[model samples]
Target chain A: MWSRRTLRQREELIAYLLVSPWVIGFLAFILGPMLTSLGLSFTETDLFTLEFIGFENYTKLLSFDATRTLFWTTLYNTAYYVFLSIPLTISVGFFIAILLNQNISAQPTYRVVYYLPAVIPGIAASLLWLWLFQPEFGLINWALSLFGIEGPRWLFDRKTAKMALVIMSVWGAGSNMLIFLAGLQGIPTELYEAATIDGAGIWRRFRNITIPMISPTLFFVVVTQIIWSSQVFTNVYVMTEGKGGPANATMMMVLYLYRVAFREYRMGYASAYAWIFFLILLVFTLILFRSSKAWVYYETEIGGQRS
Target chain B: MSGAAIGVGTARTSVKRARRTQVFLIHTLLIAGGIIVMIPLAWMLSTSLKPPHQITKFPPIWIPDPFVWSNYVRAVTIFPVSFLVFVRNSMYMSLMITLGTVLSNAIVAFAFARLSFRGSRVLFFIVLSTMMLPQQVTMIPLFILFSRIGWINSYNPLIVPHFFANAYFVFLLRQFYTTIPRELDDAARIDGCGVIGLFLRILLPLSKPALGITAIFAFTWSWNEFLGPLIYLSRMETYPLAIALSFLRAAHGVLWSELMVVSFIAMLPPVLLFFVAQKHYIQGIVITGVKG
Candidate 1:
């Protein structure tokens, strides 16, 4: 019956049919919710009642009454965590990757040991860290006492709670380390040998050859870490008993939003918070991509290949 | 001539000594880091086996005396429902989500990767962009949507969205699909094999590694998921291990030994899976990094 249609047209129809699931999902799950949420920000709704209140949620959040709203506090706390955690995670990961790439004996075993922590599920790890961060009887404090230094009350104290979380994040830097190691291994050994022969010392060779070679990987790591860190919830939620406590020192945007929407039943206000977060993430990602051309090295580009 | 030979011998020995020192330093640093990294896991096991009296000892016990292995039994039994109920719920959810994700995403990926349809490029690009749209953006509306459909407190909200395919898995599988030669597709076509036949018979078998990666990821994600289960599954029996473990902590004053035992039990499957499929996991991550 459809024989009159060309083979290409028929194949195209089949292709469309094949991808229809994704198209439907994209609309129903992603785009539909996205538009609904945006619309929701302009109204007050608690699933049953809806009242149009244009720009009130946004204005309330962005207004000077931040003491009550905690908009700025959540934003600041999230930024603090993201900025602090990513650097430590990335650097520790990179350092380990560099060390592991040294052609050592039992490299795979060492890689597994380093990467093991990352495999622990978020909840389990958080709980373990909670114990480890216990003020007196924890292994961390015991180790500190061995050096004749009394350790701070970690998760209990607001001043050190966020820092404690940062330290915990570094433990799982192994996943990032694995990525960096793969990136490191991809660098041509011949380039290093050539640099050595050119009288480039260790520091010089690393600066000139290694850094440029892995800049793309660095960019990838930084962007992903930024995104992941900004959206961090499970660990903080688990460790802090879902409160983001110590006087809201750990009050991240996602946790705060979760509270507003679920705990407090302020769905419309939470939707407004969600949009602001979405926009902030979008801007950051866009900035990273736009900045990539300046730093992210492409060996293919140098070879005149347009892949 | 003898003096020159001696000088060369001395120089060679020094080089060997330097190399030895380098290896020693590398091993020392790696071992130190490894020990520090393994401490929490070691402490977990140690604490899990320690009798309740030994848990709070100052300087912390490295090994448990008498090895109270009953903590595991206690952990499993202490729950109002059989702890295995959480395990069963988690297993069901993980398996269903993995199946849905793999099948749906792979088909969608094959279409994008192999088929020449109008707007495919733009559509694929849109799909990739959706990856950046964090779940927070849709969380509230999705909750409302689910509530309206009377899907609240059900597994539908948790498992069903995955059947629509996600951006990350679709991208990963599409990249994998494009690597296979077009010649195979042409040969299959000449033999009167349709697109679905090619996918089922040829591509699926050839793409085991990619599929395995996707499956493992989907399984682990589902297994480790907390927020979704917390939101959707309200009943005690319906709780996955993550929620159940949190409940244990919140309801009871941290039963340190039993809690560790439960946490270990909860984490065991994924960790064991990781060990078995370490290479594939690493490869999947590398692909994401390089491709992204």
Candidate 2:
């Protein structure tokens, strides 16, 4: 039999060996690139050589109109998107979940139909939406026309492109809808019964018991939605026909960073833009985390098993 | 729940009538919403079968007349890239990446879950934090590193990173691993099962569902991945369904019939996966299959 000391050492060695892939990944892909990105921000790289030019790339944002303008427009577009998509998606999803939780028939069919949009590939979804949002001949405008309402030129008109993007995003909110469904299922029905016994109407039961119980899922959805919304690239990339166009109206931060790094070959400048974007996300996430204490309810803290 | 779960047992006649209306209203609203949500997908299929001219018809033909089955052939042939090539590359890459991710993530997750080593908790937290870091943050530098090593146009760029455990998958698998009681480990240990034996014998067998979920996730992600392949694989031969669909989109911008055919082709696998694994799919989503 193996000695206890040797056995412990072997287990430790095996542990390191098992997790070594992550250690390597973290160093090579994550931590290494993170620091390299910071370093690359201060240096220019043209695939062969890196030239250290200290804060010049950062300064270019303020000094150069094109770069500064691109930054501002992308920032505005993304901020607007994140601001609109998160609340809209969550509220819609939560509302749908509550409806699904109702004692309605054909629940599975309803669930499948609701979640179908969430599974469609972004490119395909974009193509489908592009057709629908067409100024003419598309289903959306055609439908609107029947009601005597003229539809805006979506994905084409600069004014409505960002709105179109947000709307498309909200359509795919079924992922959060699924989560909210699970959260609703997890909520004890006994609480609803108790509330109803106390003469609470449906609205009051939802307000007092349901919302507080599902606050953690809300927090989860909000945080994840923010991250996903901020990284909106594929739909915009395809919808704008790879230009982020209509006078840069739909240029999200990631898309702009992409144009800088790959298209323009301003790797250093792109790195600076990336770092600033990261800081913005970091700050927002921190703020949300700090604010979570006031709203996010932990079942474990209130004596339930789940943490 | 109000009547059944409570001691009230049954509602009065008026209340029951109101409840009937409420239920009817709920079903009506849900069915309406479902129809609205399904319209785009329905239109995609509708357009796929439509003849070229009918695509832009003002009335928007709901069904194709004489159903142009040739649209599929033209859609596949019109592209400089082969649809088969895209599927093959996608399958190869997705399978390899899935195998790599599921195995790597499971192994690493096992260590984090069962192996109490120095820095394990901190490293696990590192895994969780990586889930928060957006791919946009690392993409450029990773591309540079890959291109430097000439992995730019190959499966290596796509597949190699996955051999290193993914943060989200590791977290998911680790969560699964923890749910397995420790007494199983003690029971196995009495029979002289080593650390590897405990994982391979006890945990691995108990984790078929978790592994299934992880493989499904990894496959769907790599299959649906566009930007990575778009950046790395510039060669037409290496294109996945996602990028190839983009090429057809870019080329024949108004060819709605062809676009729909290709779009339907592009959509088949993930949709099929959802249908085939409907139960597992819902379970994965509910169990927090880390939002992509």
Error of 2 at B136 (Å): 1.5
**Which stretches of candidate 1 lie above 4 Å from their native place?**
A1-5, A302-307, B1-16, B290-292
* Local accuracy of candidate 1 as per-residue lDDT tens digits, B1-292: 1111111212233457778898789899999999999989999999999999899999788889989999889888888998888999999999999999999999999999988899999999999998777899999999998998999878899999999999999988998888789999999988988878998988989999999999998898889998899888888989989999988878764688888998898899998998898877777776676221
Pairs of residues at least 3 apart in sequence or in different chains that clash in candidate 2: none
Q: Per-residue lDDT for A13 in model 2?
A: 99
The superposed Cα distance between candidate 2 and the true structure at residue B52, in angstroms, equals 1.9
What is the docking quality class of candidate 2? acceptable
- Model 1 per-residue lDDT tens digits across residues A1-307: 3474677798899999999999999999999999999999999988789999999999999886867698898898999999999999899989998888776667778878888887787899988998898887888999899999999999889899999989999998898888888888778778999989989999998888889888889998888777777998998898888899989999889999999999888899999999999999999999999998877888877652221
What TM-score would each prediction reach against the true structure?
0.95, 0.95
List chain A TM-scores, every candidate, in order: 0.95, 0.94
- Alpha-carbon RMSD, candidate 1: 5.9
Candidate 2 C-alpha lDDT tens digits along B1-292: 1112211123344557778898888988888878888888899899989887888899789988978898889889997755799889989999999999998999999999999899998988889888888877777788889998889889998899899998888888888888899999999999989999999999999999989988887887788887888888888998888888888788888888788788888778887887787666666666663453
